[model samples]
Target: MGNQTSVNRALTLINEGILSGVDSITLEQLAEKLGITSRYLRELFKTYVGASPKQYALYQQLMFAKQLLHQTTMPITEVAFAAGFNSVRRFNEAFAQELKLTPSAIRKQHAAGSMKVQANSINLKLSYRPPFNWAHMRAFYQLRAVDEMEWLGDNSYGRTITLGKVRGYFTAVHNSEQSCFDINIVFTDTDGLLQLKRIVSHIRRLLDLDADLIEVEARLSLLGNALPKINTGVRIPGVWSTFEAGCRAILGQQVSVEQAVKLLKLLTAHYGERVTVGGQEVLFFPSAEAISKAELTELKMPGLRKSALRALAVFVSECPDSDVEQWLKIKGIGPWTVNYVRLRGLSAPDCLLADDLVVKNQVLANISSDPQESELIDIIHAKDKAAIKSYYLEKSQLIGQAISPWGSYLTFQLWSQQ
Candidate 1:
């Protein structure tokens, strides 16, 4: 752990390179990103991560596929390919060997429970990382809480999100007594369950559950006297699907929070496929393909903006294997849309959507304004400003050592505060 920065960067690189999309990298390339010889990177990974770089990459690839299989309706073969497995036969073999269940069986196990499990618990399971600050998350949502459509779940802490079109309700509880988090979301019987796993995955991402907080806290301990009131382990709220998050971002453009929520409601209600479950109305964010097939021209969108939104959806539809980079290129889409999707949809742990008007104004008001870009740029500079800040803090007692592991979490917490 001597080269904390390099090791930490390497870890993020490894995970991102594997999970960022439908591609996986070789050990040699991973070594290059860490600025180390392949042998050295292999040794470093084995020592710190308990697995060689290649093994870790394989684990990530396979596990991601496993999650998708258990959570989605996607064919096992497709999940295998998406997770970078070379062949469905190999994926089935490994999954059966490693997890004691065939990939197909895992999907069957869930599908079998379609009737026995309560409506709320059927589609997903509540996931969490250790040391989650549940109270803080509930409080954060409460402050910016929407009025009618959402309800903060009773006595216990949780937020109720009433989506458009699809009928569903999700309630999250930090089971302090159990030291585990609990989530229950029941959607009207639809194809949405196939996508629910993706939603839960993004939620885990936004909350930064993947963060290694101990390393981050160690870094923040150093900046001691000069730092602003920095908090550790703060999590960002994430949205489930990229398109769903993107649509919300579009609705939020240049409007007040209340107005944006209204627009969100209007858009979902108008374009979404409405459903009723447990006697409540819920909407599912429409897919690009679905939107492309539907008639949105008569909806209340502004003339060109309507087409712009449709174009964005169409762009994503055309590229079924869409990622953030592609979403940013569509007309009327900008840095804000991508970052919003990254934060809410993709659940990127360290992304800060300072590109938004509110966030930009907050940045300028809190820090110096060299330029509008400077405000956004500051967060990305110096191998991650939050990383730098955390490293400086953790290394306060050290002279020139690398504070390797905590930078990602540092970035996550800082962006959450902003």
Candidate 2:
């Protein structure tokens, strides 16, 4: 990598470290991890991200502390330590500086409107821009919901989650009245407040909490019948870990969604970590390192696909970014899987599955349709499948560029039509 690219990569890594609550790591240790001098790392962040890494880390921790105070009834001291503060005094000073309010007062203000909760559970709320299409989001996840670890029912989505070695489960129900999700979390311990922070962050991404729907709609609306109008909030559903999502994309290649989900379930059953809570069994998807070290011959998959899965796991173990060129180096991976992983896993806003079968079909139809649809079929049959896909991919690139950053949402809308 070029020096500037390396600096950008390090900055991205540092941002993730901060968000993941790496408050305990010393500056020297972090600099060593990034293979840069501490002084240079400080300069890069000051130039790009507008704050020192330490200041950013402190702000993230304090934000989590603020959320805990507003949502949970945990004691102030426990909240302090859980937010990575060494003492309640330090937490108080930081909290006062950031929000201009004491933790106790914040809790008191939230208590009046808080939901009734059991002793061991935490109740919180997740917000998104309005006009959300709950049905579309639920259907997308429900189609591939794993057997034991995840499920979508009625209007709510629930799943078992694992952070490091800590295991917990949470459910989110749409509260149309409040324009938010009423999230209920039941974990093994009340002291797992740090785990709660990680869980909340992942949940926000999973449901695309940070998306600006109004802006997306405005940009997309300019395309003018280029994409069907979605009256509600449509978002690209994200996974907790990019590794798992990449593996899924590999498994999904050239297979029906049902078949791919079936293989994933079997893979989980065979190699995933097993845990039980309240008589219900759940499995954490196997990690990249674990899969990279495992024997792939035991699985009933094609040899090329097995190789692809293992190669992907190994690549991810070494480098965590969603590098499509690196991914295409795998044996069975292609543009479709690479872009699918980018759109869903890394939360890349501009990605489009241009090579997707349904997307190609839709783009071809949009380009030319005839009376009785017979001419379209004849034209489709006249060309080789590769030629047709290449033709549409070129056209889709133009359409995708026109839409710019909301291409992922447009991709989802096209898929929903099928």
Candidate 3:
């Protein structure tokens, strides 16, 4: 692994060690997966990834262990084993060896007793690679806010979302929570504590927290300070429930945000389940099953819209276990709608909803009120030939990568200007 190419190959292998799927993969199995001699792979990985494959695996487990320690009511032994260690003793030994502290010690450090869960919420910090403009980002959130479900006020953005059947609320205090963003979660179930870590991870993506800002700056250098100051890589503010996101998307079709929000509130007040918490009326996003069966035709929405919304409801109802993104297959549920839901609802880090007016304008020579699916077809519709082709080529690559890990923020930057 001395040459540049060999170094690249080994680095590729090491980077492939994603945090997911580590629980089931053993060191011996990973060696086979990398197709290198296990010992050599071990030595090279330690030199490159800064840890042996076994150690890396343990590091991943320790991260999971940390998640449990902070997010769950699980016993330390159970947290150890669930993180894939064979026993509590082994987990403690490894925790001490790698982290230089026992699992119990870490748990005590963040204990509910020691740390206050203010306003009935736990504060969490999300890390990011940044050139973030918090002022601009908050302004964007303020513009697109929905009523009751999500709102921007009191110098914070707050909303309630449904995770599967579980309902929870999050409030983002722009500066108070931690490094990039601080969010507090108030949930219905204590079991929800464990789920918060993954939710936090998704929120980071939705916000484009992990984006490589240096690369982003390079790509947008042509836009000069307009983009950097404007926050082209701003993150997508996410929703907890895909159902709520779907409803919001449906309401947003060809309408002003205020109008769309009014319609959404009408729908929720009519169909969404009501919960009483902290003296506020919190409405759960309507489930597919509920939407499918309920009489939401009361909204008097257009027939196409009614059908689309109904289709979304039935889709959500049928596959009760699948994510809302997985269940969105109604005839009118095209790329735009699904992509919107993914961006905001499912917390997809890089989905580009092509139907968005912002995305279209950002990637075009001249702005149209629309940048539809047909725009993608216009490669064949090149009437001006060379000039049009050159124009498209210049902007196309940037457009494609706009949403890769930070598209929502890109969208945020564009919309904030509006």
Candidate 4:
């Protein structure tokens, strides 16, 4: 068998690149990022994705262009450039050659159909595999909604975003009946169309719209009584950026969720930018530069956590491309913090947060409550922090092997049980 692990990691990097607006990424660039030769990368793609890297990139661009044409009022020229084409002539040629239709023909067909166009906003449908428990997803965000920067309605969630010179807000309304989210995005910048692909990719990650629930559920089903009755559509609800997620994770240490959100609100109000879009006011999360320089006296958390926050901000500011593993060098940041960021911030599929308090409690409650395992519970709750952590780590790895690569989902499943 081929190296499934390498293929999975490579695919994740590609998706992350696209989500970060690297639409014109070349095979050599991807290979360099993967630390592999182009020949092997091409073979991996050909075997797994059924296409060469070039073909796959082209397909993504065309699919994005077609969605824009079918769903939004963007002009064909803007659509071409937005989808990473240098010129409309080339876009038209490629579209016709690959899809057997011209850009104008597609636009005409879209106009002929039932199209709903809203002024100053782009509306699109994001699909997901069925059995999506949107209520659980909505409740998760609703509980931790930050003021001004995020808002949650009964059936929808909206948040302000700052994406490299583009400031905007998007509202994703869950349509359970249709198995998708009807998202409406409004941007302050006129050049926002250029960032549409990245924006859509972020929304997909944020809502976890691309997960195959059937496969995930089936794999997670083997854990038996260890996990609560598997919630049908538990997904990793993501943050806007890794930096934002890191900040949230640092602030959340040794605190309740409500207290963590209060700290976030205070930090946002102190340093985050405020803007009005479509006559509605919202706040963007603070930038690394802003937090790196601040004294953080406004936050009432422990001084060590504040230091950790600034250290993270400085690390992100200096080495924007550093891996999450590098964050451990900072004092007060540990495995649980890094794993939390990986699970929710990057949506990594294999992270098992064994050190998490809720996870530990849930696992102990289920396993320790058994009369035969009572002595094991006493050993776990013993005074030695290091030993306790090691025990949980070992236990989580055992469970993680059972679920294999879906440990991130397992983490959420345990959290959802609380």
Candidate 5:
């Protein structure tokens, strides 16, 4: 048991290093980041992940490069450099060796069958392991979507995105036949591969693209017959930026979800940046720098929530290497808010929103046999609320551990319940 735990820890650290240094990371630097020798990192990867660190990184680069080739009209030279290849010849050689096809051939094949979109946009097919519940995903985003920034239609979901100074929009429709999401991204700049990679990564996180649904289902099945069975492939929704998630969490502290969305819309409308994409106006979420410096006296929320928002913005803007502990340091940031940010913003899979009203109510409903659901809910909120909350938190933690690793998904499943 001890050895297995140690291996998991080591792999997690090494994976974090790789993810944080995808564009230009060397094996030695990755090893240093993991506080181990390069040889040990190589052995660990070979033993567990079945690939050397360099091989993994190279594969990622090649895949991203291939996506760019098939999705955009970028020149071969630009694609080569953008994909982090030292030269176009190296890129061409790598493509031939890895994919057994020339870059031009792949592009030509894509052109023959790719979806039509604006000339300035790019389209990529993002695949997921199957059994994904597209209806649940659509409803989840539609319910709490902020105005102007997000859109959820009959069979599609999309949002305007802001990554640093670059702003763009992406619309995605699920291709059930292929078990993939076909996303069209329209951006203002195509400067380098780094930005493109970041945008794709953000989208993957937002849409829960990389989840192994089979494994998640298997783990979650341990909690008896308690989950929302109809939506077995439900995914935990993710925010585009940590700052935006934090602000939304703070805004939602004491209000219902609908009220919180209203406040968020007001905040964004008052402070966010407006950009035009495909002849439509979209507002980007307000930046932390702007929030931290602005006088937000006009916001309709109470003083404490306003203060919390500013403090969160200041912390996120000033401390780039943020953690839950740093977030907890803010005056009004509680465990629920912090965990909400962790789950949705940072895409941490283990954090559960234990203190949320809906979570507590749903958990109580699952555990208790009381037919009077409303009566039980009133008891929870009436007197001895603190004790009841503590009991629910303890039970929820135990249940969460039983589900382990996939607690975020479990939380979403619980949320999906009536």
Candidate 6:
């Protein structure tokens, strides 16, 4: 088998390429991007992913094309290009060979007429497993949402988005009856059509629509009674990108969520791009270049934090593909900040934010009710940062092991208690 780290790194890059609508990426190009040989990548995929790199990419592209054919009224040629096929003939041949039916047959069976399409937008349904606590998810976004950048309605949530050079907005309405989100996407630029697959992938990550909560809750149940009954439908609500999540984490330090939201609003107002989509004015979260270049005097936070924010932006701006571990080298960024980025930014399944204050309090509350232990908690609270970090680290190791691979869910469950 290939080195585990290299194998994982390769897979992540491949998936990222697929999501970003780079349909034309050859296996050689993918290998070159990872600085590995194509033979090594093929071996890695065979051992871990059960297919060659080319086969996997083709499968994903075909699936995306199938979804578009079934869901949208776009012409077959458009669907072919949007899903990354070079020509309509190749798309049809692959569709026939893989599924034993043409795209037209699948579309006719599914019938796209059921979906509503607006003047400048396309509507698509994103599916997820049932027992989703959408109310909880909605409340989470509603609380931290920034004006102009995000909005929440009675049964829907909408936000502005920036994907590469394309800027637009989308609204995802909760369809509990259908166990899906009916999303309407409006792009200011026509490149949105070409980027349809990538946009859908981002929305899936942003809403966490593909998580298997049944298995997650089953494993988290191993934590026993330490947490309140595992909340059903609890999933890690993710941000649009890791850089955005890192910035939010840095700004959120030592402040309430409300205060953090205020800071985020100020940061957005100053650095984010402004665009009008479908007659609504929206702001795209500032890019790393924007944040790295500005002085950020508008933010009223401590000087160290503003410095940290700019440092992170500069790092991301320069090294867009670097690992999150590299962030620890920055001055103000720490374990909590990095893990927060992993949990919410990347939607990583195994991230345990043992260093978060709220997570620490919840864990402490669950493990003990004794007055002496409470006094110890008080003492730890009064002690230096090192002491507090040590205490939580030791305590978390006990439960953190039992909840392997689902620590992010456990973190959210603990947060839901407050």
Listed in order, each prediction's TM-score against the native is: 0.57, 0.82, 0.68, 0.91, 0.83, 0.89
Write one digit per residue (lDDT tens) for candidate 1, span 1-418: 4464456556654554342333445667666755688899877877778887767766766677776666556666656765666677877877767677787777887664332334333433445555666656666566444343344653233333332243465666566566555555666654334334344443455455665556556665663332234664466555545777787777677766667666666665566654565566545455577776665654565655566677877887777645566776778888867777766665544453434444434333343333544533465464476754554344333421323333334334444565
TM-score, candidate number 3: 0.68
The collision pairs in model 3 are 207-235, 234-409, 235-409, 403-407
What's the CA RMSD of model 2 in angstroms?
4.5
Evaluate all candidate structures by whole-model CA lDDT and list the values in order: 0.56, 0.74, 0.61, 0.82, 0.74, 0.82
Return the clash pairs for model 4, or none: none
Task: State the lDDT of candidate 3 residue by residue for 164-260, as single tens digits.
Answer: 4446777766653345566677777654443444455545544656557677545545443224345444555666556767878887888878788
Q: Cα lDDT of model 6 overall?
A: 0.82
Model 4 weakest lDDT span, ten residues long:
15-24
Q: What is the lDDT of residue 273 in candidate 6?
A: 83
**Which of the two, 2 or 3, has more TM-score?**
2
Question: Model 5: what TM-score?
Answer: 0.83
Full-model lDDT, candidate 1: 0.56
Leading candidate by TM-score = 4
Error of 4 at 43 (Å): 3.1
Which residue runs of candidate 5 sit more than 4 Å off their true CA positions?
1-47, 70-73, 96-102, 105-111, 114-119, 192-194, 225-230, 370-391
lDDT of 2: 0.74
lDDT of 4 by residue, 100-129 (tens): 999888888887553454445688888898
Order the candidates by TM-score, highest first — what do you get?
A: 4, 6, 5, 2, 3, 1
Tens-digit per-residue lDDT, 1-418, candidate 6: 1265566556545454442344446677767766789898889889888988777777878888888777887778878887877778888998888879898888888774646445468888889998789889999999999898998998999998887787899999999999999999999866777777777777887888878999988888777546747778898888988999999999999999999989999999989988888888889999999999989899989999999999999999999978787899999999999999988887877787877778888877775455556644675568666766676677689777788667889999999986
Write one digit per residue (lDDT tens) for candidate 2, span 1-418.
2445445445444434433343456776677766788898788778767888788777777877787777767778877776777778888998888878898888899876655545457788888778788888998899988877787878799887766666778889988778888888777665455556667767777887778889988887776545645545788888767778888988887889988988888777777877776456676788788889878655677888988898988888788544555788777888888788778876666777777888777656654554454544565879767766666666687898798767888888778776
Query: Candidate 6, after superposition: displacement of residue 314 in Å?
Result: 1.8
TM-score of predicted structure 2: 0.82
